[model samples]
Target: MSKYRVLVVDDEEDLCEIIRFALEVEGYSVDVVYSAEEALKMNITDYNLLLLDVMMGEISGFRMAHMIRNDPKTAHTPIVFISAKDTENDRLTAFSLGADDYITKPFSIREMLARVKAIIGRFDSKMKIGLQILSYDKLTINLEKKQVLLEEKEIRFTKKEFEILKLFLENRNRLFTREELLKRIWSDEAFVLSRTIDVNITRIRRKIGRYERNIVTKLGLGYCFEG
Candidate 1:
């Protein structure tokens, strides 16, 4: 089996070296960057997981995570925040930014290794299950590529928008209340408001062009992709 690649981003050189050594011992291909800016410059999507520190120079880890989430290419990559800020709000913010897991500073190396293995294992299993392309009329969703094509023309969609469209197309004719959508798409990690789902749905419809009407909003219910 090919070794998994991991990127560790922290301002502290010692911490980066320590994490790199530990992960390498566990048979992972590890790379370390001392700042979020350097991490951003690299092809981030190449790694299987990101180990990010919250309080970094210039661009904070939170800001970096936000940028990663906004970029379709790296949006789905799993992130784990390793920071000293161990507050409830801090954890919430990390999760809201779509982090797979969060570990406060002064954590055990063994525990961190365990968490890394678990998260990567789960992602591998999902990949094995195959998120194949789903097609409906002129619309095509290539889950692996994270691309959406309407009438054979590629349409750019934000991370959330792509996911929302995928869910609707995969479960065509199924009604999804905003609450259900929030839970299903964002999971419990991110604190996404109901209004966010509405916004994404609107954007998905607009991108699909003439097929927009197929996504009907039921009164007192929710949205469903009739096509």
Candidate 2:
């Protein structure tokens, strides 16, 4: 089997080197980038996990996590934030961004390794499950292929849009609060406003065409897929 690929994004060169050395010793294929921008330029889908620092030049790790979740190819890849920001709000922000774990700075290398192992083990098991295909009204989603078919015609969907649609379809008629949707679809909820959900839902409605009516909005509550 191939070694698990990991990307570490942090502005501190020394820290990056230490992490690279440690993870390499653990038999992982590791890549190190000093800036979030540099990490963005890479094929993020190539890595199974990302170790990100919150304070980085140009783009913060939080922003990087948002970008990753918005990309269909890397949306599901697990993220663990390692930063000095350890406040309750900060940790919540990390979890909202869909991060699997948060490791505050001044952490032990052994602890980091243990957390990484656990997160990877959990996700790997999930990936081993057989293919899943779900259909609602005229829309069909191939979970394994990450493809959507609308009445037999393949439709392109942004990663976030596809995930939103999939969640609604799978839980048909179940109301999903804006907060719930953000938690379910995004890795960094702080960056995604309630309006963002509205925008994605609008786009999804337009893409699915006639099936749009199946998605019902309950005033003062949230949205539900009634089909």
Candidate 3:
């Protein structure tokens, strides 16, 4: 199993180590930085999640989050704010800036670990749905505009194909049987044979070229996007 990488940004060194130790015990690959300024200087694209403290030195966690959201590379990354400020307005501001969760200071370690696991498990699905964008490396979809880009170039997909791709991206690493695909994508449409789904899947693989292997065939089990 692959471990989830987490970047924890907080001003207090002791707190950072405590969080890091706890997350490491949970089998996560953890990194900690004492300041948001330091975090901003690094390439954060590879991290699966970010735990940021809202208050810091000159560069605050909210400011860092805004910058992260504005950058296309990290725009859709999951962010959870940890801070002593627990006012309603503070939480509202965090969510408005695309925070996935807010953790108040003096939180229970068990609760924090549970929240981290839950977010990492569904972060991609939830974040993609809200932002109207699903991306895996060079492949990207603008859900609102119904656009698909491969290697920074536009790619055309039929409506059915697009929907199937969206479903796969939303539920990566989960297998879907042919019958399940037909029910979800074809719905009540009459005369749609299971073979049609196979044909569409082939076409989608061909179109994606280098990423074709990302859509994995699980022998008798079914198909899944493994990215």
Candidate 4:
């Protein structure tokens, strides 16, 4: 099985390192950041799970979690809250924000590891039988394989193009503004212009062949897949 990539976002440097080391020892790929701001700047959609600290400078983990759940690309990623605050209200807030689990501070390493394994395992099982293959008329895409097929013929797409097309296909008939595309597809580290989205969409349409017209442009509303 492939190792799951996990991101730990905490303001405490020592705690982050400890968690990172522990998770890495458990056969998982792990990355640690010291703040929610830093976490948001990176491409977090690639992570299978996120371990977030509830309290931090500027942006609290709860606020970050809200943002993550709102973004289409990262909305489904599993989130776990680790905090010293053990109030019932705190736990409720975490779950309300779509947290998979909440771990109190000074938790046993073994227990934390077990919760991580269980949550990721459950999500993996669900995805194996869920929307892995999406079909819209003659166009089909395998989310797991990142492959696109048109009329049974395979088509090549750049990473960004594939992501954009996947978004369009997943939400057929829903118009997506260029700003929304940039927010969902590109990381904050990159300065992507609206023209960049247009170019990628053009390439996606060209590669799809006969399905080109399925991706329609509204005069002032942005883009959507008519299929």
List model 3 lDDT by residue over 126-174, tens digit each: 7667689888989888899898899889899999999999999999999
The segments of candidate 4 whose C-alpha lies over 4 angstroms from its true place after superposition are 131-226
Using lDDT as the measure, the top candidate is 3
Q: What lDDT tens digits, residue by residue, belong to model 1 across residues 98-164?
A: 9999999999999999999999999888776555778788899988889999999999999888888
Pairwise lDDT winner, candidates 2 and 3:
3
TM-score of 2: 0.59
Candidate 4 lDDT, 63-146, residue by residue in tens: 999999999999889999999999999999999999999999989989999999999999998888576888888888888888
| TM-scores for every predicted model | 0.60, 0.59, 0.58, 0.60
Clashes of each: 0, 4, 0, 0
Off by over 4 Å in 3: 124-227
